[model samples]
Target: MDNVISVRDLRVLDGKKTLVGPVTFELAPGTTTGLCGPSGAGKSTVLRALVDLLPHGLTRDGHLEVQGRPIRYGKGDSGLRSKVVLVPQTPVVFGGSILDNAVFGLRHLVRASREDLRGRVEQALKEAGLWKEVHNRLDTPAQSLSAGQRQRLCLARALALEPAALLLDEPTSALDERSRDTVEESVAALRGSRTVLLVSHDPAQVERLCCRTVRLEHPETMALTSTAA
Candidate 1:
């Protein structure tokens, strides 16, 4: 498998709290990797460190790469961040129409043609299992939608950017059973095409979507493969 991301002895420290282990893992293209750890174990931080979104002077060590390219650290690499979108635990739906929220940042940060935008947006919404529920409500304010809808909307928003990799922090944690199923389906479909790193406490969910699993015990500990577990 072609590797898209690699973390070698990655260390991330924020003041006195170390957020990442000397993590060493490689993400092969088109495979899904599930990240599991105790709360505050820095599963999210590992991803953020890769994208350089940690607090200023957080201090990151070791080598990281993405899509065969070094994950360029430092400032002014906004474009790189776009290629590796991170969807947090909370759903972030803006106050505007759902369509606007989905395509809002894309218009300014993304440079796709008008035709491409329409197709990709529709595809993402459909893939996210939101198209049927939102087909006629594209112009409706996202606030009018239910919380579950908003969560799916965020997933759609991330998918709209055409990211090569997606970092998800419990993407289904805030949803109901139905909404959770939608997220699971979306993840199942996403695994073989995009490099996905998901931090999930749900073991069943991890087994459903992940090809491999890694558990981070503490900041100084090593990333242990759970595929053998």
Candidate 2:
């Protein structure tokens, strides 16, 4: 497997609490892996550790390399927010218009021009399955959108980066069934090129999407399951 990411003995600790592993896994390009566990089992924390975003007063340990090199702090090697995007649980819309929120991250691309950015953000919106509903109202506040719309906007924001991988933490927890399907369809489309790591409690969704499954039980039990019938 052409591994896009490799983690060895990954550990994350927040204050005095051990949030994630002593865990290890590799994410190969063209594969989707699901991180399955009950709430507070540190599923989200594991994703955060991958991105070096373990919240307030948290620290990470162990070897984590992206693309092929060690991610050194500061100098862009460790900027997981850019290379490894995360879509948190619930709808997290930025304080801006729909277009603004969607295009927010694309502005950091020095090689991309303004027109290119606008065009690409719109394209991402369309690809996220949320274009027509908000295209005419691109200037409207992002928070004004429905829960589903907001979630789609977040997906668009993550896609704006053209990230090497995406980490989702309970992405469908707050959506209606229809909205959930929309997001799942978008995720479905991302397979086989866009590497994805998702944390979900829904067994049906897990069975449907993941190429592999890793179950983290409490702080000590870890099982990696293959997608075999």
Best by lDDT: 2
Candidate 2 per-residue C-alpha lDDT over 93-196 given as tens digits, one digit per residue, 9 for 90 to 100:
77878888898877765368779888888878887888988889999898898888888898888888888889988888888899888889888888886889
lDDT of 1 by residue, 1-229 (tens): 6587787888887665566788889878888899888888888888778777787779787877777777645544767777888888999877889888888658878778878787778888987788999898889889998877787788888888888788888988888898788778877887667788998988888888898888888766765565621
lDDT of each: 0.81, 0.82
Task: Evaluate residue 146 in candidate 1 and report its C-alpha lDDT on the 0 to 100 scale.
Answer: 80
lDDT of 1 at 156: 86
Can you give the TM-score per candidate against the true fold? 0.90, 0.90
lDDT, candidate 1, at 31:
82
Worst 10 residues of 2 by lDDT: 72-81
Cα RMSD (Å) between model 2 and the true structure? Answer: 2.3
